[model samples]
Target: MDERLTIASAKANLEKGSLSAEALVGSCLETIKQGDKDVHAFLELSQTAIEEARAIDARRNAGEQLGPLAGIPVAMKDNMLVQGWESTAGALILEGHKGSYNATVTQRLKDAGAILIGRTNMDDAAMGSSTETSHWGPTKNPWDMTKVPGGSSGGSAAAVAAGFVPVSLGSDTGGSIRQPASLCGVVGLKPTYGRVSRYGLIALASSLDQIGPFAHTVEDAALMLQVIEGKDPRDATSVDLTQTTIPELIEKDVRGLKLGLPKEYFLEGMDPAVKKTVLEAVDRLVAAGAQIEEISLPHAEYALAAYYIIQPAEASSNLGRFDGLRYGYHSSGQNLKETYERTRGEGFGREVKRRIMLGSYTLSAGYYDAYYRKALKVRSLIKKDFDDALKIVDAIVTPTSPSVAWGLGEKFNDPLTMYLSDIYTITANLATIPAMSIPCGFVNDLPVGLQIMGKAFDEYTLFRIGATYQSLTDWYLRSPDTFST
Candidate 1:
């Protein structure tokens, strides 16, 4: 069994009868068993993974038609609801909680014949930038066990990087998916805000959160997105994509395409090695006949500030339902008020509580206009910045994260420094545009990602540029040494 098999290759092999779904799923399960003890990427393994694989194999043997992802094994972030399985969201509040319904993406993947492997760990309530805040434990980078694999989607990214699965699902609210993918040296895509349905996902910031795919290659990521992208009646934010089809990303020609390099992204404080590697990638695109132009996003500097205010405000509202009156951890108290306070106090983590407090304060009387409303205005300006830039350039390119993977505990004590980690990725989320992180080069032996951003619902352009870049480089082909053993 080839442990490095990608979705496309795996599908081809399965179709040719050269690979059985059982063998493929078994290889991934074995890999997880051998490596997960040290990596801690998975929070729970799916009991039905092998059974599902057997069902797919039986159908194939009977000559039934298969979907694009038929027999492919997939891991999902714990925040996504999968009926009959635990969906803890890495928080103590929902420990041992079982999902009663399937998330739209989960159901879509199941319909496409992909085998659901397990749920991976993440930041508690998907609030932190690193997985260190997970109640269970942090997921270590596959490249170096001492370092972090970025988050709040760290486990999803780490699983793909560790060769446990070809693809995994992750949510990005201010770079949760892209930043982790950059650190893990894999492909992560955060589709446009309304491109995919959000029903059944444990909300972080309803306005900013987006579910996407993490895979070893751009094609695999695209394939997963294709299977899951579309509107659902259950989610009002979902947009109808019946008239517009996702482009088939083939590495044909990239000539005449103009890509922007935002001046704000290249500012000081960025690691010198990361800058050099990304610039080298830009040069490679230039050599491939694409044009690189310097662009200005003046409001980009304010994106981080605006995102923090808006995201927390939305998060506070979304998380209000978990006050122990419903289904989550509950603490006993003398009265109703005390019960509410005690339940939240004990059930929530420090970071989650802090954000809730901040959010509550921002939305309070007299402060709404000064903070939340103003932040919404700033968000508009940030979106306008991308709109203006896209009018001239086909897409925007930048480093996925300012630096490569850092030591597990390096930024735990300093929240401000940790916030800066998503400086490059938050802008795209704020703008509600599609963006992707593809492995471009290495810095001190750690992988660096080149992020490609496109206009709303324009994932095809981002995928085209990413696929083209991957075709000219072997960075995505490399894997952690632990996998080879």
Candidate 2:
């Protein structure tokens, strides 16, 4: 069996009678058995994965029409609320915490007959970029074990890249999905905010957080997005979206498309090799008939500063629910205040606490306008910039990061450096525009992600452009370096 089979290919194989869902699920399990230890991608393995595949086979034998994603084994990030499974969000505070119900996305996937493979590890409370902050353990890069798998969605990306699973759910609040996807050599989508339901995702930063898919191909990401998207009464912020259909983008042509390069993204401080690979990707996309245009997103320069302020402010408020009264870990204390502090301080990872403190400080009476409120105004300007650009271009493309995957323990101490990792990505969340990351090329044998940003609710353009790029190259098919080892 080809270990790197994509979701569409797997479905086709299942339909052609050349492969069985059971066989496919077993292959994924075998990959886990072979590689999960060295990679540390999964927190648990579902005994039900094989059984779920068997059920799909049973349905097929019964002549029932299965959904597009039927029989696929998908890994869920630990942060999503899956019934009968814990949604830890990689924090000891909520460790072993199972939701009373399945999150809307989980229920939707279950409806489409996707098997729940297991929960993958992430940074505690989704606060850090590297998976080293995971309460359980660090998720090493599949490309090079010594280097980091860019995270808080590190495990999700690693699993897909290593072929443990073809698709997984990852929540991106400031590039958790795309950054890790770039590091692990897979495709990650951060659909426009509210494109997918946040009803069951453990909130990191409510406004910034979005749960999307990680896959080996752009088509697969679109497929997963199609499955999980739509409005729900459960999440008031959920957008009223039309049902989407993932088309034949892989073999389709996208001639005369406009690809915008934000001047802010191409400026200095970028690694020469990453810049080179991304520029080459631009050439390839252009060769396929895309018109490259240089655009200015002046407010883009302030995205990081604005994001840090807004996200943590929302996070501090969202995290307020964790104050020893409800949910997971509660500490022994003589008074409520002690319980609150001790439970939070002890339960949360260091990075989470730091953010909380920063958030609290920013939102305090005297500092609110200077930090939180001011950041909101700048965020609006950034969103306006994207809107203006989208009017002139079909899609905007940029380097997913300033450089390729950094070595493990390299940015752990320097919080500012780690924060800047999402420079290219944070603006999309702020703008509430759909953006996606695909493996554009490699830098030093470590993959680099090429980002495509689209207009609000315009997921089609992003997919069309990304799918166009994928058709031009086979970077998406490259297996992780650890796969060989």
Candidate 3:
């Protein structure tokens, strides 16, 4: 064993009686203890992994019905509430906060017999592109310690990359999950909006917020998705979808698959290296029997502006609960007005405060139509682009991010630049489509992700295509020996 096996390989070993879930969990714990100092991926680790392993073993011994992920240990982003564990959302205000109740996804994972590995770091309240905004500190990329892992779910992706955990859950609001997974060289999926319950996730942009999975292989991500996705009464936005079985999806070949290339995504000033990776991926798909064609999404140019407006507006309302009256920390104040001001001002980081102010202003009486309403209209158009394109193409392909993972502090100060990091991803969230980031190539020794956008509720197609590519290429199997201790 190479010490890092894909879900398929691990499960095979367990089924064949060559290894046990307990042994795998123990190895993972050892890896975390030895490597987390450099990766900075995990905020906490489950010391009781052995106990969970024992349960897994007992179930197997009993020949009882086993969930697909019976013993897989998975990391979870800190924003989602997991009972008895601290759910920080990587913000200073919620530093000591504990999850009073299990989020729907957490409950589902437990029900599926998956072990909760630990919580991972993220941008403060899931605000920035780089994990540097985290109160705990930035999650360094497992490929390069001096560079970022990519944010708000950067820690979760890095945890999987560093072998701290086999798979992890991340929330996306304007590319939080996909971008980080791209930069960290892991398989990350941002499912169509409403595919997964957002009940316990700390909201950043409610309309755009989505929970997703990150793993080293496409099948592992699919496995994780199976356990967490579905409709839930707790989240009114959650929608029921017909999921394609992973085993069947994985076996499906790419022959005759039509892949659409969005012209707007290949704009001027795009990094040469990033463009190269995307083009090479296109060629790879072509070789795999996919018919590639360039398609124009007319209103695609305005996706970022539209996304920024809608996201912040949703963010403002969603963050209103943190007024310090009910839960979490509160600062000193003599009156209610001062209390709200003090709590928010002191709680949110600079990037988060900026968005909140922008959101509040946009939704205010006079500016509502000019900003918020206009953005909503453009959002409709952008969504139509995907809907129309999917009519002809099975899936769309693009660069997951504008560039490879930059230095930790590179774009931290410039919010617009940081927001642009999600250029290729936000539109997927806006359109409520399934999108994924898989390792395509490297830019200057750093990984780049080839993003595949699927039709609404068609995550299976994305997985099928991604698995085909991963099967043909050695990218996913490559490790960062320089960073993963």
Candidate 3 ranges beyond 4 A from true positions: 1-3, 483-485
Give the winner by TM-score: 1
- Better candidate by lDDT, 1 or 3: 1
Score every model by TM-score. 0.98, 0.97, 0.97
* lDDT by candidate, in order shown: 0.92, 0.89, 0.87
Clash pairs, candidate 2, are none
lDDT of candidate 1 over 336-420, digit per residue (tens): 9899899889988989988899899999999999999999999999999999999999999999999999998999988889999
lDDT of 2 at 157: 89
Per-residue lDDT of model 3, residues 380-447, tens digit only: 99999999999989999999998999997888888888888888888999999989999998989899
Q: Candidate 2's error at 382, in angstroms?
A: 0.7
lDDT of 2 at 470: 81
Quote the positional error of residue 327 for candidate 1 in Å.
1.5
> Candidate 3: lDDT of 61?
85
Error at 426, model 3, angstroms: 0.6
The lowest-lDDT stretch of 10 consecutive residues in candidate 1 is 242-251
Model 1 has an lDDT value of 0.92
RMSD of 2: 1.5
